[model samples]
Target: MPYFSICGVPNCPNFAHAVFVANYLSEKLPNFFYKKIEKIPREWAVFLDELNRENKWYTHESPVIWKELYQWGGTKYLIGGLSEFWEHVYCYYGLESLIPKYALDELALDNLRFFADKRRSEARKVKNVAILGAGQLNSAILIQDLLEIKTLRKGGVHLVFKLYDHHQNIDRSVFQHLNDTALHFNSTSFFGDFNLVELYSSAEDAMADSDIILNLDDYNPKDADFGKHMNRCTIRMKMLADHLLVAAKRDAKIIFAGSGPLCYMATALSKACSEMFPNIVVITADKGFPFVTAASEETGIEIHRISAPVVWGSIGVNCFVDIRNAFFKADVYRPYRCSLTAPKGSTLPLGVVSSELRLMGYKIKDAGVIERKVKNNTKKMEDLIGRASLFSKLRAIGLLLKLWYADEVGDEIISLGVRSNGSFHVPKGMFFSQPVKLSESRVWVPYSNYPLKEKQTKKRIKQCILHAKDVFGNLGIMYDPDDGFDEDWDDYSKYLGEIGEGEEEEMYE
Candidate 1:
């Protein structure tokens, strides 16, 4: 981190905020991230003081330029692994205890380099972070966290936010709380000389030169008149994206956090609908777990709902007695194509219900009536372990933060079910979530589960993307990847080289 700081790269603090947003919204916002910090690491404070003495860090481009020079074979030590660089630092700077110990043996060093790969956090200088739909409380909470809390990490960063929102009457109470707390803060972790929060009325104004953009708006997609809403929102999103593409700085990471549920549903639906005629027979949901055949053309598809009492089994809990009859059934359901409603759970289970049989043995379809049994099993698991709404959404947000910050943990690894970036085996704009080993854009598709260019996977991914494109494109948005007006295609060098001085003569010859 001190090395990155000295090199002029901006670093994000891994700050955790105390949630004072009241208990009413506690159901949506979990308590895990809310806990207060007990102690600040003493070593980090000493490091900060040492960093303050360096003039190279205060100036921006020099450190970055120096780094680029090093990467381009300027420094032999740094060109190798982190340990090699640190070994020299230990001798030269005498900061032996400050840095992680390097290996003495060649084989040991090689193994350590492979195990603790430091290349994961290699992105340079992200100073500007923007949030779309900045009016929302959740958005504000994220922003407020940046302003107020500062966690000690490798490279300390100064953040500037360009917030864009339709609702201008933003509740700035969060900032007030941060400001009040900033005075009481013992550690000099929050903010640098360059910190600023700028508000923008338009996307064009907001996106320019932003290193990271967090888009949080759903355009009221969960509303009753969502079809009309989608049309309006989609147009707005397209225009917004156009502005963003043109305005956002080169190599900017745009965390497109808009409507993940749609992607999840489309993927699930595609899976259920893959390769078959509509007949009541066998189908597979999980590994060798066969089920969900529709009895008729129109089968009632509902988000799986169970009475709250059935889940809790305790009379003391008020939520168990709510008049809504049943909780939001996101986890399970009858698999089929049906009307989508807001506040309901997921469509994956319904996708399972609607699809026809796969392979059938002697009366296997009759034996495949395990929908009720599966739901019961799932419910039991949930009861034992407990379940929460918006778990996927929250997880996605956490992932975005980790990626944005380029977080480095120890040997421990975490996996997330996220939308694929059209990398490796996954097709572009895959709506369904795939299990990926979490860390800066490192997507792993198991060769055993999915063979390279597996026909079924390819077909399903294609189907999902097409449906999303149709639905989202109707509202003037390209929901899936397309080559239309690609910014990457625009090359000024082409005009210079394509029609050169001798181009006409060469053509004639």
Candidate 2:
């Protein structure tokens, strides 16, 4: 009955960060393989074992034997200093599955220190971690971390993991590496701090009281159409909605996310979750901080934005490596178009996100939004939207703006909101992206009629709204554009409305 969760059918990076956190706990339990790479060739074990005994972490210098050991394994090493330290951690712990890539560095280590201090302040530390559909290299990396780790959390709850993989090979292979689990693996730092339990249950069973639900699967976008993807995503959401009513505890967070192309599935999921679980807050997260700009919105200010999932994943994975002032560290802005691989010279997985963040809130101007408030002004990035077909861009924006208002329940800020109450003379539910800044985080729209500064922005917003009918129709939903009420649509609907063909004669009579 412990709290456990999955965000979505996330890909490699998300899984990796989950594992990074799962096995990472303060030195209170048996964590022999914490930070160790598993499933290594037998050839290098003895060499690593002997070398590990002689190394100490305090030295800025790499051990003389580290290079020779690297050649013995024929590894493609990126950072030599980091490689040496991690190799030392692995050999000392008597564990495997680590590659040269996932090593510790100064900045990453500093981030860890900051994270530990933050976690230490929390009331509860250890919690249950469940990974759903984990079947990639990230899975392997995660099992290693969950099986053992070093971390400090607020409530002193060292995270334990319950991994779910349908494939026999994946489950069996990961299970085999956890042989030491029964006996409780040994590590100098975590000799007898706490106990970790291994849990295995059906996905539905684990949903009960889960603090998080990561919806990271069903990413197939049919015929390159997001509406098609939403069709599939909607089915899944319906199932989850039914299941969660009886299973999920109140306040559980469900993040509809994944890798691959920007599909409308997440958008649909957001809408579906809100409709299904009125009491639960649904969040959209990804391990990637995808780049999106409000510059073209014709707004007063344009600030570069990264969604929450990416920021969380980046810090989670970094703690697996080293540390830094993560509490105040807005991770380095690494732009990735799309892929599993990290940027060059970095072994951490690619930063990913659902891009569910399309609004610019007034709270952004508040302190702590920018990790340390280092910059005086927000930096602008070239609209990475890149030129795309009109329909594609429209669909993309829908996903970005999905649940924009709903997600800001507690932290409400002025944002682009839709016309729901007919305050704008637009159709009751027409797409209306207005200045929805909150008078306060809890306040909803329309404290005073805040108007748009530019006509072009309004036109652009109107077009996006008009196209929603198309997006809806693609998903087998119908809409009569005439029912829509916009300045342009009103004139056109009037032309097409109640008047018969060539009615000018009747009018003259």
Candidate 3:
């Protein structure tokens, strides 16, 4: 018995002929058995090349046939292509014409139609991800991360990246590089049925039908003066809010990844689109860098071992890295142990371990030292490169996105700058970075399980609220302190007494 395998492009005439002949032979001869494999026309050449390499044969073209020699330990015997298969059948089994020319043509045409329809269906299922600052380093890094994600490589919903950047700032070379990478991935079948990476000259076109929008627009201020820098950021944020309001989909999740006042920008965006796009959630991803850095340094653990440390308040100077609820792998640090002994290879809360260390007379660096370290490192990188280092920030954004899309994070908390609905005793309608967990529906909500009872922590959060108000006032963005708060809500104004105006100024200085 000869077990035959036939493979070719679905739309090829020879494929139809081969399929017809195989079916006829199987029906007439009990000893004959065969299976047909359909490949897309674009992949036919690669498939043929792979087949040839594996079999040590030089055959090419559609409808390549081979037979399994069952008696010879299931070894494969090359039977060549459609014409060769016909000759083989004629020589061995005394069979000649099987499929008519009209039938072959009709079958091939039908295959072509089916293939076209399938491609159209797949295109419709592909999700569009729009990158507003397509040429920037951060955008490039983010795209690279997206391409390497293993879930996307496995067959599922495909992605079509729509890249848009200012005409003068757009880097065509970067786009070409990303396109070439995608093509290489396709050639190797790394990305199954992936779509194209398109560059859009118009923002509106780029944002159309987009499932996600990553705002990586470069707003790094070149001005040395504080007032001038504030003015530049204000203008850029206003322009971005306007563009997003007009172009972005009402349901789309807009991520603000630009280097500016992230909390303020997210607040402005949320406020601007609140009425028309009420479901629109603006996520500021800048706080991830500081949050991770502080956690790793405090725990004396590897960055990857640190799970989550919440960033409370604004993103930059006013932000406080709260490790109260953060956890790290206990196995990473053998010497450090909390008051209670935990099983090996378990996770431990960072705050508990830090407290144990302090009780044991081991000096732990204060929050001010950790904050200074982050700021100094950023400043040093800027001084050397003439621009702010984006690698840490890029990693932060990637981790945040991963957490956002993942099914669960267990007890780990993620720090995100989201508009406050009066959670954490902060003023209503203010954009503050708080300890948050992803809900069952994948929405980020304030993590209220661990009460923020630390008096010092509460006081700093109040100061942050004041600083945020100052920033909004300076930028001419309106915010109501009492908005969105319930009538029974306790007076948050009393918490501000602990943070003096001079102390707030000196903290940033």
* Best-to-worst ranking by TM-score: 3, 1, 2
lDDT of each: 0.36, 0.36, 0.66
lDDT of 3 at 185: 43
Between prediction 2 and prediction 3, which has the larger TM-score? 3
User: Which ranking of candidates, highest lDDT first?
Assistant: 3, 1, 2
Question: How does candidate 1 score on lDDT?
Answer: 0.36
Residue 286: error of model 3 in Å? Answer: 5.6
The best candidate in terms of lDDT: 3
CA error at residue 104 for candidate 1, angstroms: 50
Candidate 3: clashing pairs of residues: none
Q: Which stretches of model 1 miss by more than 4 angstroms? A: 1-126, 144-153, 169-192, 222-227, 258-395, 407-432, 437-509
User: Against the correct fold, how does model 1 do in TM-score?
Assistant: 0.36
- For 399-446, candidate 2 gives per-residue lDDT tens digits of 332333233334332223222334433334332333333334323343
